[model samples]
Target: MVTTPRITPDLSTNVGALRLAFPTLMASGCYGSGEEYAPFVDLARIGGVVLKSVTRFPRLGNDAPRLVPVASGLLNAIGLQNPGIDAYLERDVAKFAERPCAVVGSVAGFSVDDYGYVTERLAARDEIDAIELNISCPNVAHEGETFACDAALAERATRAARQATTKPLIVKLSPNVTDITEIARAVEAAGGDALAVVNTVRGMAIDVERRAPMLGNVTGGLSGAAMRPIALLAVWEVAAAVRLPIVGQGGIETARDALEFLLAGASAVSIGTANFTDPRAPVAICDGLSTYLNEHGYAALRDLVGAANPTFLGTR
Candidate 1:
């Protein structure tokens, strides 16, 4: 008898009105043009898709030496290069608006107004379901990092962004912090609806002969399997402290990886670096999770959320 992964899910539910087949989703910057990847895999199969970070204005990003290969992962200073908000709406965002799957727009800016102005522009458009704030863009300005690292500054930026739009706000926090909980709470107090934790850790590499940094930007954010444990831990800490829903992501290459985030208190999970490894990663995860659920007798994906939390690990 031939058998296949079942798309049917009884546990099809979520933290709010957002019901999902499984908690799997694609990380921002992972999936290329929706129109481009459409041939490789069904982007809509996942819970949602976070578009690459857009800015208030178009950016060409950094110089040629922007990507470097590290032992465990890839370091990138792509510089959030994208056409400004207007071109994005006319081009990328408009394309996805026709799809039934949730479209999460990711944004970045150099200053407080950069963030707020971007949000306001997105709010005026109904094409996106939510906005994922990339306060942790590691490539360009030191200012973006400043907002992400300081608790007070993080709060101020979040509050300003929150005031700009009524859309669901999800703040992506950097993993470089010693205490992620402090930043998470600040977002909650400032009215962020959800969180996408642990943005890639900052790192650098050197070219021996050139005696210069490998990446044109000198340093960049690291993403891939190497960041899994740190990402999981950060998600766990933030989830435990904040009541907001979380979209856990980083190095999620397989179904088990997605489950790890769900157990860590993430309402949904995002696939980042793995996409570079396998373009079909997100669809594979969606199908893999459905099979896991049907085999385990769980009715829906929601039932699995936090079921594997350490608090539930050793039971009599």
Candidate 2:
């Protein structure tokens, strides 16, 4: 009897002080606190689960019609609607802690103090493996001017969070900037452990028949396959600028998309909007990645990271 060869590719990775069993993570806001997806996908199959951004106070989010479907993407102005940090810690943290995978808590605020407060609170929770600072939300403080839009502001925010927590800090950056590398370097210098490159791009949709906007917020963040190229560029630029690990994400929908991000310089990849289309997308990508690694004679996932870089290939 002929037997199939056992394929076991090392998919482990490290982001600063935090080590993951795999290289694919469920993006923030895509999987809530993970309870919602527990009935659908295997929560422990992926590297980590990043919870949705939680504020100091419960939010009602924007008005009606917050999500709209585009050709190759989704436009959403959900406004970070979530229960306050206290509620999350009291009700959700334990649930996530019970899981056998890494749990990454996400925090967002309107000011430095707000960021610091949330970070400090989450740092006390042993259940949380890391903290993802969401500095890219477009409808937040400073008259909707995201902290990621300015290098100085990004550094200030990172500094505040760093002082507040000893947990691994992953700063999520915005793509709506003049030079993303400046913000990336500032975050790294300010003690950020890792970076999550290319948050949803700001975009708008209209209802021609109604002569109005489609999203309630008028302008929403665009995500899905449409943002992959822009996300790749951001990862390429930021990876070249900082020595810190990167969690690249944008419109990743398959294993091939995740591979592109890794080759571009991401230590790990985050599956976002694709989760909405296929509940099993993350697990499928993980399985497919293993197959690709074995077929290509790659011993580990890290071997593929930044493989496309000219400097890494000695082609520059």
Segments in model 2 whose C-alpha atoms lie over 4 Å from true places: 1-6, 138-144, 311-316
Query: Can you write out model 1's per-residue Cα lDDT over 143-196, one digit (the tens) per residue?
Result: 335677878777877887899988888899999988998999899899988888
Q: In candidate 2, where is summed lDDT lowest over 10 consecutive residues?
A: 307-316
lDDT of 2: 0.88
- Deviation in angstroms for 21 in model 1? 4.6
TM-score of each: 0.90, 0.95
lDDT per residue, candidate 2, 39-133, as tens digits? 99877788889889998889989986999999899999998898898888888787766877798989898887878999999878989999999
Clash pairs, candidate 1, are 10-299, 10-300, 11-299, 11-300, 11-301, 12-300
Give the runs in model 1 whose Cα sits over 4 Å from its true position. 1-7, 11-22, 137-145, 310-316
What is the model-wide C-alpha lDDT for candidate 1?
A: 0.78
Q: State residue 288's C-alpha deviation in candidate 1, in Å.
A: 1.9
